[model samples]
Target: MKDILSVKARLGLGFGSLFLLVLIISAISIFSLSDANNRFFRYVDGIGKRKELSSELLLAAQQRAVSARNLVLINSSTVRVDEKNIVNNAHRKVGELLRELTASVEAMSPGEERVEAQRLISDIQQIESLYGPVALNIVDLALNGDKDAAVVKINNDCEPLLRKLVEVVTKFIALEEQTSAANVMHSQDEYELQRNQLIAFCLVAAIIALALTLVITRGLDRALGTEPSILSGIAQRIASGDIRAIDEIKTARPGSVLASFGQMQASLSALISEVHNSSNVISGSAQELSAATEQTRMGVSQQRLEIDQVATAIHEMAATVMEVAHNSESAANAAATADQQAQTGGVTAKQAVAQIEHLATEVSNTSQAMLRLKQESEHIEGVLNVIKSVADQTNLLALNAAIEAARAGEAGRGFAVVADEVRNLARHTQGATQEIETLIASLRNISEDAVERMEVCRGLTDKAVLQISDTDVSVTAITTMISNIQEMVRQIATAGEEQSAVAEEISRSVTRVRDISDQSAASSEHTAASSMSLAKLGGTLKQQLERFQI
Candidate 1:
């Protein structure tokens, strides 16, 4: 065993030994608890299951007999079917219960109890084998409509079988109950044995722990060379900054375990002396440092205010630039729309010019047609005048013929009749010719006036076509200018966006600078406070040191 110089270490080792003993006791308790649990489970799985299965088997055997009797007595087909089903179900349940009982018996630990459980299972199986077929045979007879035969069979076969099954199942159930009781008693004995063993182990561990505690306590007393109370009082004094206690400890135990403490006391005394001297110097320096820190804090505060104002201005500039950028973008969109409309107008103007030129051509063609109509009218007038002349000659000829006929008397009577008829025809022809000539002259004048107006209209149409062409040229130029204006506006918008971005970047930089300045000002203030705290701590340390004797 190494010497445990520290009181805490000695106490810790002693307590650790006690703890190890407790762990051992706990382990033994856990093992005992586990064993008890296992025994309980064995009781539940083995003997408990055997008792439960035996009771179920006995009940199923009795139920099968009852259902078989019901099959024999009930006359209706549906009642017979239900009775038969009940009998079959009871028989099946009996078989299952037998199997469960066998499994439970087999699972038990090999011993006299297991042997008894096996014998009981055998007896149960024999009873089920004898009773099941007899019950089923009675149900079959009844189901086949032989009710009297089923009643006779139930009296002869099923009743005796059922009585024997009841006896065997009762015996089996009794055996299981006895076995379960024995297992319960055995489990109690095992639990008692484990508990006694645990108690003995705990007693032994306690003795060992007590011995370890005694040995460690003695070792601690020998290492410390003082009572625990005296060491505790010294430690308390030291913790409370009573360095004067070091002198009392040095004088009280000059050549004891407190030898190292005496050397530490001397070292501490010199250190305090030096600290006392250093505190005065630190106080002076701290005052100067605090003054300088204050000046720096004030300067930083002024600088921070200036930076904040500048940052504010920059932010305003950035906002203005963004507004300008938004306006420029709106202007660009408007210019684009104007350019598109101007181009559309230019196209419309060109189409109008083409239409006007077409109309001018049509107008000139109309003027030429009017002129031709006028000339045709004049020719018609001349033809009418010729017709008038011929009619006059014919009239004159007819008059002369009439005169010749008058000279010839009766011969002249026939010739004179023919001349009178010819003269009448020539007169009618002359009147019709005069009317035609007057109408032709009016038509000729109207045609000449129409031709003159058509000429004027053709000249005006030409002027309109020329003017439209000029307008189209002007519109095209305007469209081109608008497109150029749109391009310039777009460039301006892009430039504004770039400027906004730059302004934003400048704003962010200014914000960071302002934040850094704020931090610097805060840090200077903190430094000044820390210097003052250090000065006060130095004075406190000197005061604490004054309690020790050099």
Candidate 2:
């Protein structure tokens, strides 16, 4: 237990032992006081009380005997009655005293003192029993006016019984005195015994306290490996940051507090020296890192500016491509409109060729009417009128075609001029038909000569029909070529739009790159500032480490 016990445990054990000893001493004192108090009470309630009651019993017996004698002698009735009451009262008092003495004797311990006291009490009671009735009978005899008989009985029975009762009462008194003396001696002896025992225990407690003090003092010295005052001084020095080596620590016991303090001082000195050197290196490295970060920030800033300029140039190029695509789209729409107008002009040329063929048929009828003028000269006049009407209709159709061609814009301008020439030819044909009508009266005399003219007119109408077919073919070819040109223009516009979109995408990518470069530049500035701060903190750490002595 001593091997495992700490300094606190040893101190606690010493204090607890001292407390237990104090408790034992207090208990001994309490027991001694309690015994003395019990002895005093026993004297008062038992032997002492019994002694007083026994003396009273003796006095009552004597008082009753005297009162009984007075009852026989008194002659007045009032005096006799007073004597009788005195006798009864004295007798009753004797009985009360006897009972009280018997109880007190019974309360005593069952030893020789108690046995002798009990024997005396019993004798008093027996003698009182005999004497009490005799005394009372004498009073009765005296109260009845029989004084002679009461005197004779008093001498024969009352005197002898009373003498025996008095003797017992006197012996009981003596026994109570002897018991009271013995009890006083016993109380004194007990008080002396408790006092001696308390003194002896106190001596033992003093010795134990002295021994515990020596043992705890030696154990604490071994645990601390030094004097408490010396150890406190060393701790104060360490707390004040004085880490210098101590000469006394070499003599301290192994595994002791002083030895640990010595080891801690050595380890701390080495650690502080190493930390001081590291702080210098850290400060130099941080300064170099700060310079490098500043250079990186400058490069990032330049890169961001270059990327922004590139993005602006790409945006302008994309706008130019968009304009070119719009122009191509407009050209495609104009080509499509020109193709539709050429197709309409081809349909009008076919109508003009059909009207000329109808004019040729009417001329054929006039030639037949002239060949039969001697028999059908009236039919010749009707045919000439029909040819003039057909020519006027052809002129009107050509004029309508020319108006439509004019409405067809620049693509239809050449077709409009050709329609105007056809209209003028139709008007000339109409004038020729009118001339034939006027010469019809002359042709009835020369109708056989007009047949060759009708054949030449049919040949011209067939040549005009062939020329109109060639015009339709030319119009169809022009329309097809224009349609192909429109498709190519539309494709070119679409390609130009695609190229503009690609340029726009390039511009957006460059914008993102510029944004990223700007962020990088900002980050580089932050890193440079942080490196400078770190260098300052390292210098501060170096200063802090210098405070500890190595």
Query: Model 2, residue 312: what's the lDDT?
Result: 74
Model 2 lDDT, full chain set: 0.76
Compose the digit string of candidate 1's lDDT tens values, residues 1-550. 5552576777787788788888978987998789788877777666566667777877878888888888777777667788778888988998888887787678878888678767766776776677688788888887887888888888888788778777876776677677777778878898898889888988898798879878887876566667767767766765556555355464444445665555666677677777777666555656556555666776676667667666766766676676667667676766767666676666667666766667677676767767667776776776676677667767776777767776786677667666776767676677767767676776767676767767676766766676676666667666766766677676667667666766776676676767767766665665675576675666477677666555
Q: Candidate 1: TM-score?
A: 0.48
Weakest lDDT window of 10 consecutive positions for candidate 1: 245-254
* Backbone clashes in model 1: 0
lDDT of 2 by residue, 301-392 (tens): 77767677677767766676766667676666767666666766676677667768766776877767666664455655665666766676
Candidate 1 vs. truth: CA RMSD? 42.5
lDDT of 2 at 100: 82
Off by over 4 Å in 2: 155-160, 274-546
Residue-pair clashes per candidate: 0, 0
